[model samples]
Target: MSATMEPRIQYAKTSDGVSIAYATLGEGRPIVFSPRVFGDIHLYTNVDYRPPYIGPLVERGWRVIFYDGRGTGSSQRDATGGDLNRRILDLEAVVEAVGSDRFALCGVASGGPAAIVYSVQRPERVSHLVLVNTFAHGAEYFESIPSVRVSRDLRHIAEDQWEFYTLALANALNAFSDTETARRLAATIRAGVSPRAWIAQRDALEQIDVVDTLRSIAVPTLVVHDRADTIGDFSMLASKLASRIPSARFVATDDFARAADEFMREGEAPPTKEEQLPSGTAIILFADIADSTALTEHLGDAAFRTKARELDSALRAAIREDAGTAIEGKLLGDGVLAVFASARQAIEAALSCGRAGDEAGLPLPARCWCGRPCGRWRALRQACGLRTVAIRR
Candidate 1:
């Protein structure tokens, strides 16, 4: 499938009469994507610059669903007082609108709690649940992660310095320092909602506490996390989240794309032992801090070491958050290496590293550079020729 193929946008009305915006892409088993806070379906589905993560799934022949939450994106902005119930109602509205009796739900970031609530409430409708870089309790996230608490000051930034906040947020979410991507994301954020709605959504996100409700989920669930994520430690957050649900499977990867693909492909019979390995095209992404020698000289040994650890944590976190797998590569002092399922995923993950580093207020802010190399994997044969191109910002 070509990356330029556009998805048709449509609307679904909630029980309260608020219109929710949505779009359908590709073909096959329907998978409804629960939007991150402030997500806009149109921005996400734009053929010119759609998120790299969604493309692979669509190309693999899945009918992917995208939607804007109430008060954000192309959805009804007048519904500014949306709460948890209203959020659930929005999902319900979208599901009903899509007319899918049984489908999969993939929750990204803040969308996780809402997906969890809906899965439990409508178990019969949800065939599978996938949560990525998400937390069970909103309060726990703010209280446990100091950086998250500091980032909450983003509300003030969003309200007072709207443009700066969006750039910062885009950088933080993407975890890289690509100005072009940041600017694009900034426009998307601005087009998605007003400052007031952004604050309202953040307020609603903070109130989410679905820990007590996890056990009630009856659908097959997959919880994925990257241990190096800067938002929250996987051991501290996502692991506990997976543990709460009965029979939930926990898979850890450096990136979210491959794990997500695995989750979406669930219920299909596994390949035989002889056919277990994968072949064909794979994209490898590598990221590392730039100007480490100068940075170390400026910050000194002790401080530089601390900063390196922080950068490592932030980059790893960003990779996982972006759904790319982190490959253990030779440490080049101030840089790290990871592998991604697609060039887009790798690029996005690298960009997110810069954004995450900025949001964490690291002493030595990191800028990530990515390279894409294509290669084929033969089950038991050595690899052949490979070509790589570097993308730096």
Candidate 2:
């Protein structure tokens, strides 16, 4: 027999004639995780599970229960018909079938809606509610603004360009697995479900809306939103829900996807640049594109001009907010600067700017530098200690 250590997989039949697939691991209070079937949970375990909020929860005696929604994973393929009501019941059935009553629920993305609905229908079965990067209403989720809508037309990619779709899914999950691991998971997802099944799920998710029912959720709720999340603006959506729900708490985290992508390659060498200072100190940080001219070309003159102005304003605000004084300089066609503060603060500011650009839907360029401020920085070398570099606007 071929050796296997995969998370134990099992299936349960739902009332609506659908077989649900789930995997259970670790030990403690049952914390049921109803994840959006972007792919198999096993595939994203290493990549997606590495988040600080999750890994710790599991380690601290929480039996995390993860399952595939309808039309996903090892679940029955014929059970996928694009219905939110059915999906909600599927979630309830999974929890009940698994023998975990009064369990904690953590839902992400589309799963958030599912969890909310399930919680409403079976309020007595839930303990604590943790919603991360999720939305209450489908329309409001995608339509962050009144006029704008997030793209859901994956048919072209799902049909002819299948691999790209898998890769994109992997990318969204920040697939940190090695080439072999990624390939195996991607193949498994593609093999497990038909394109029609995915289509049904996608369409069902788009048609979902439950903004009105959010107030009825009486469970203790924790909402975590990524400042740089491209999916939906949970900041506004969470605020709306939190206001209605009396005991809800809202917390903001850095971009989980980006952070996942950055830390994925476990044994791989981290990108770092180090230099030595005259005082025998060293500085290290990763640096690359602050402003790529191609982004300007792509954004067009009008949008790019407006984006530049916004970028300038954000930068100025950051500077004014005790991040660090911008020791203004120019790098290529973009502006450059130096900071005399702690290395961590500079790195944080850079990441913050990147997040802001992404939120504004503007393609901002970026470069990071960290290490010993040695001969590489003439001003640091000349000053022998912290020294201000030339300022330019």
Candidate 3:
């Protein structure tokens, strides 16, 4: 894109009926940017304001995609933008509209959680991940800095005095810098989101806790943050995120785009053959506690999470022992997903998962279900590309 013209703005409707505004630049392999909830597409495109690092990505032959999430920019403003689920919806809508079979995902600041969640859920679609200045848990990110945590109560100020709050927020994110860029950023933020919407989004962000899901990410990831970060010392958060994921590298550099490009280039391993998807005649296994909501209410969130994690690990281990591959990222909710090469393996794994759940004393007997695919496994093949059948035990 030249400095003289703005990228064309477009829209995509989410499954839940939210319309997301987005813009794309350059061509070749795709790289979608998930900006923080407060980003403005117009402001992002402005040569004077757009992050200097992003332009080089376009120059490097990447089809860079940018979008404004719900409640911000040209998107629907009546909704909240910070919750991970809603952010996922925004990203899903944009990606489906743009039509990339597999692409690198770059998530900035608060938007990183959405990117992480997406990578975990749809490993086949995302080639790599770039997480910048973000954390997995909202509470952990905020409570580490008292002022930042306390700032939530002051969210009301956004509704009452938006101009003041946005300026203060702009400075806070920039370590209290008072540059012309900061002033412009403050104005952009104000134009991107209304005060009421910001308040709603902030409240929703506080409820997000995707730390438990981080370990499921299997894609190559680049975690970036500033060493001298002043807004809650987020570098540690970024470091912790990198350390947990099996395939993540932590880097603290000013030239993030260049670093990301170098890292991706070094790690790039294009598939020489078609992606391996499970097919033929196989059985799928699923084991989960029945009525988990009641159990969570009884055990409390903390205790329930610990028990659930333990049970999940045990079930996965059993699945592996039975010669089955655990599909950890699918729609299991409180359950676990596993695919087996045979009915005997699937049934045995299902029984073991049930036994494990019982031994874990989850208070409710775990339910087990498995079955075989009817012929071509078209549902799995066409959609997730996962080979799956089913079993009941």
- For this target, which candidate reaches the highest lDDT against the unseen true structure? 3
lDDT of 1 by residue, 85-137 (tens): 88888899999999999998988777788899999988999989998778888
RMSD from true fold, candidate 1: 10.7
Of the candidates numbered 1 and 3, which has the greater TM-score value?
1
lDDT of each: 0.67, 0.56, 0.70
Q: Which stretches of candidate 2 lie over 4 Å from their true place?
A: 1-5, 39-42, 45-54, 145-151, 154-157, 164-192, 227-233, 254-393
- Candidates 2 and 3 compared by lDDT, better number: 3
**True-vs-predicted CA distance for residue 339, candidate 2, Å:** 39
* lDDT string, candidate 3, 166-199, tens digits: 7777766544534465578778878778887777
Residue 113 CA error for candidate 3 (Å)? 0.5
What local lDDT does model 2 show for residue 180?
54
Count of backbone collisions in candidate 2: 13
What's the TM-score of every candidate structure? 0.65, 0.55, 0.63
Q: Go through the candidates in order and give the C-alpha RMSD of each one to the true structure.
A: 10.7, 13.5, 21.1
Which ten contiguous residues of candidate 3 have the minimum total lDDT? 269-278
Number of the top-ranking candidate, with TM-score as the measure: 1
Candidate 1 contains a number of clashing pairs equal to 25
All candidates in order of lDDT, best leading: 3, 1, 2
lDDT (C-alpha) at residue 137 in model 2: 70
